[model samples]
Target: MRKIIWLASYPKSGNTWMRVLLTNYLRNSATPVDINKLEGGPIASARLWFDEWVGVEAAELDDNVIERLRPGVYRCMAGETHDTLYMKVHDAWGRTDRGEALFPADVTAGVVYIVRNPLDMAMSCAHHWGVDIDTAAESMCDPTFATSRSLGGLSDQLRQSMLSWSGHVQSWLDESGLPVHVVRYEDLLAAPAATFGGVVRFCGLPFDAARVGKAVAFSDFSELQRQEREKGFRERSLRAPGSFFRRGQAGAWREELPPELVNRLIAAHGEMMKRFGYTTHQGGNDNVD
Candidate 1:
């Protein structure tokens, strides 16, 4: 029953882009896939999905109780579907308080973990969360950082623990007991065909050069941005849940990001960044084309 493929990433990473790419490749339509009408499964943290799958009243349950039941809920979800389920996930990979894995391995086919340079991601994070730049940077440095709390009332999704940027990356890449394909946001820009083609092959999906190329072209940043401009993004866009598409450049952080914040992120995420060949030094950024 191993048919669930998780597309996991920290918030503001290229998770949405990956989803669009995969969907478009599969659809292979004359036009790009609609950003708002994506066909892949909803995010793992979607509260309604849990309530529906678990067949319980979530209003009575606390976050911990709901989280504890998530693994089984996912297993049940996988059992219901005969085809592969490409699900979006933002929660850090780990076990629940009761020691059950948040995402059990038996039902998981694989994971596509997308990562972006934290330096560039900081500004985007700021815009996405409607927070100041400093708060965004600090949150990434925070090991206990979590969001989507339904404290006052219910929101669209459940609270997801991010466990800081570096920890988030480490959780899925190193800790999660599943086969993972790592995709860097910068690589998607620099080598779309090779990068996305690799992802297709890893998922055991049929990879046609023309199809992959068309998907890549269809999901281009400018195209996404233009669509957002003409209409609007239902996902996070400038914290208004509006534009969603911003500067997709790799190393633009050097000119825009504050110097002090750069040092801070480097200090917090230097090791993980180094592991992915990201510069751990101050003032450093991705050397993208």
Candidate 2:
């Protein structure tokens, strides 16, 4: 049976980039896998997958009903696969309204949690969600923040509760059921080889430096941007007019975020920022470039 390994992250936090690298590495293709064709595995929230498993349309079910059934859906998925399946998830680690674990331990192998600086995340999220940086920053702090809860029609995916940025990070890191490997997006950018090699090792996959190098090169930001420009990326939000792979720079927040917004984010997330080596106004080794 294939054990499920979750590629968990906040939105706009390089989750897709990691998936691309893993897909390339796994396929060992002579040519880079098409950006849209890269298969890390199915998203946990895909409505069709849930509907197929439940024998009923997910769109017709109440959110609470769907939440209650999620653990079973994942358990069934885990049994169906013959190899380790790396699935992407944006839901915070928490329980359903009925008090069941959102992701049952019996079905999970481990998790690779990718986190980015909230300051940078705010800017990228603003572009991705077609909102102002200030709005994005506010959403990051909103404990009830979520996506894919459309009332007018069914969303392509299921509802994913973020539970605030800090809460989301803490929930996974603190959960004891699964071994979690944390990857800082900035660290991945600074040292792709070392960082991704660690990820491969964590996933119990043998590391080949040459293979890692090629995967990194193939999935480089420039290449992703090029592909999006040539053929539009499906994952690109309809709300955003530009490509999904907008500026992938690490510290673009410095240029994009207003001073007041930066301060607000710093104040809201100061403790977690300190824990992750992000320099707040009060100051601790400034890791941001």
Q: Give each model's whole-structure lDDT.
A: 0.86, 0.86
Which pairs clash in model 1? 237-244
Runs in model 2 lying further than 4 Å from the true structure: 280-289
- Segments in model 1 whose C-alpha atoms lie over 4 Å from true places: 237-242, 280-289
lDDT per residue (tens digit) for residues 1-289 in model 2: 7788999999999999999999989988888889898675689988888988999887787788889998999988888888888999999988999888998888788999999988888988888889887888899999999988735435788888887898899999996467899999999999998999999999988889999999988989998988889998988888885789988878888778888887787877888887777874554236464
Error of 1 at 272 (Å): 1.0
Instruction: Indicate the worst ten consecutive residues by lDDT in candidate 1.
Output: 280-289
Total colliding residue pairs, candidate 2:
0
Best by the TM-score measure: 2
For residues 1-289, could you state the per-residue lDDT of candidate 1 as single tens digits? 5479999999888898899999899889999988887866778988789888888766667788888988888898888887788999999998888888999998999999999988889988888888888999999999999988756445767878999999999999999979999999888989999999999999999879999999999999888888878777776633443357778888878887888998899888887888887884443554232
Distance (Å) between predicted and true CA of 152, model 2? 3.6
- Superposed by TM-score, candidate 2 places the C-alpha of residue 73 at a distance from the truth, in angstroms, of 0.9
RMSD of each predicted structure: 1.9, 1.6
- Candidate 1, residue 120: how far the Cα is off, in Å: 0.5
